[model samples]
Target: MQKYLILLAGCPCTGKTYLVNQLQQQFKDSFVITPDEAKILYAESIGFNCKAEKEALEHKVWQFYYGVLQLYMDAGKRVIISEYPFSDKQKRQLSEFAEQYHYQVITIRLVADFDVIWQRRYQRDRSPERHLCHIMQHYHYGDTLENRNLADDLITKDQFYQVCQMRQYDQFVLGNLIQVDVTDFTKVDYSRLLNELKQIVKL
Candidate 1:
């Protein structure tokens, strides 16, 4: 059976997670992987004190992340991986994996207006449901609020502007390129997007 490798690239708060969730619902057997969820699981496994151990924790988390990806690929499972900002090196790595595994690849890039992203980020940071690792990445270990300290900004507005303007997450095009403008989530036609992807790779 031919498997597929779906890669999603986007900046913060651009709705990559939302699209992944929808895809998972459509393709129930496909494996979905994200770094944030991986970090959370690893932190929880070690009793959740990761502030002082950021570098060590990150190393372990990525090791586990790629390890799991390899496992699914070896098993010939359809995989969907999401990245905040897919680097050039990572794109090359995925291309190699697709070649080795004989899997069709589809890379989707999601984008949004900076103001829309900022507003979404503001709300998400304030929400109690925000993950602990994300909080620890920017603020102190015990800090629950992401916007409490301006000096400890997660990624400054200027930095985010540069990334977006420079089209950093705009080039993971190893296979078919699907660019999605997610400034308005409600306006997104997920069914159409899914159907388009289905035409490219067997769901």
Candidate 2:
């Protein structure tokens, strides 16, 4: 099987994880590296006046993520990074990682209508202790309001969102990238994506 550094980048609730799972089932010798799913590990390490302890927990998650990344890379496993790539710095990090390992980068940028994603974001379960809780509620912890908008306009806007920004990819990466319009994923012809992937990474 061919080795691939597949980066599933997208906005919140854009189905990055769902796409990652789809790819894992489609291919062999594949492993997904997602630290977000490790929240269960953080659940036990947070709360009270233990801000320092919470920070430590977050650090450990990164350590665990990178450690697992090393193991999979060493084992020649096809790796998928299912994380939000919404910044130049974040996308560059994925590009650099692919370059450092001589692995061809296949960035599958998931996209959707701003309003669709915004609606989904608010409907999802967002506990106060979770990451980005402050940004989600637009209020600090233990704060409340009669009405709050859970959608973040800046992050949801494609023009400002780095991953969805086509010009940024032109500046940050040369090629071997494709966009998956997930606005209607269920009705999408996924075989088209597979054909496009063949053009770049030989997956």
**Which of the numbered candidates is closest to the native, going by highest TM-score?**
1
Please provide, for model 1 over 59-114, each residue's C-alpha lDDT reduced to its tens digit, 9 standing for 90 to 100: 78878877887778888886555555675757766777788888887788888887
Error of 1 at 172 (Å): 2.8
Worst 10 residues of 2 by lDDT: 132-141
Compared with the true structure, what per-residue lDDT tens digits does model 2 show for residues 81-161? 455444465565556555666566677777777677766665553444434422332323343333334533223344434
Candidate 1: where are CA atoms >4 Å away? 47-52, 79-83, 137-153, 163-167
* TM-scores, all models, native as reference: 0.83, 0.66
Instruction: Provide the lDDT at 149 for model 1.
Output: 44
Q: Give the whole-model CA lDDT for all candidates, comma-separated.
A: 0.72, 0.57
Model 2: number of backbone collisions? 0
TM-score of 1: 0.83
- Record all residue pairs in model 2 with backbone atoms less than 3 Å apart, i.e. clashing: none
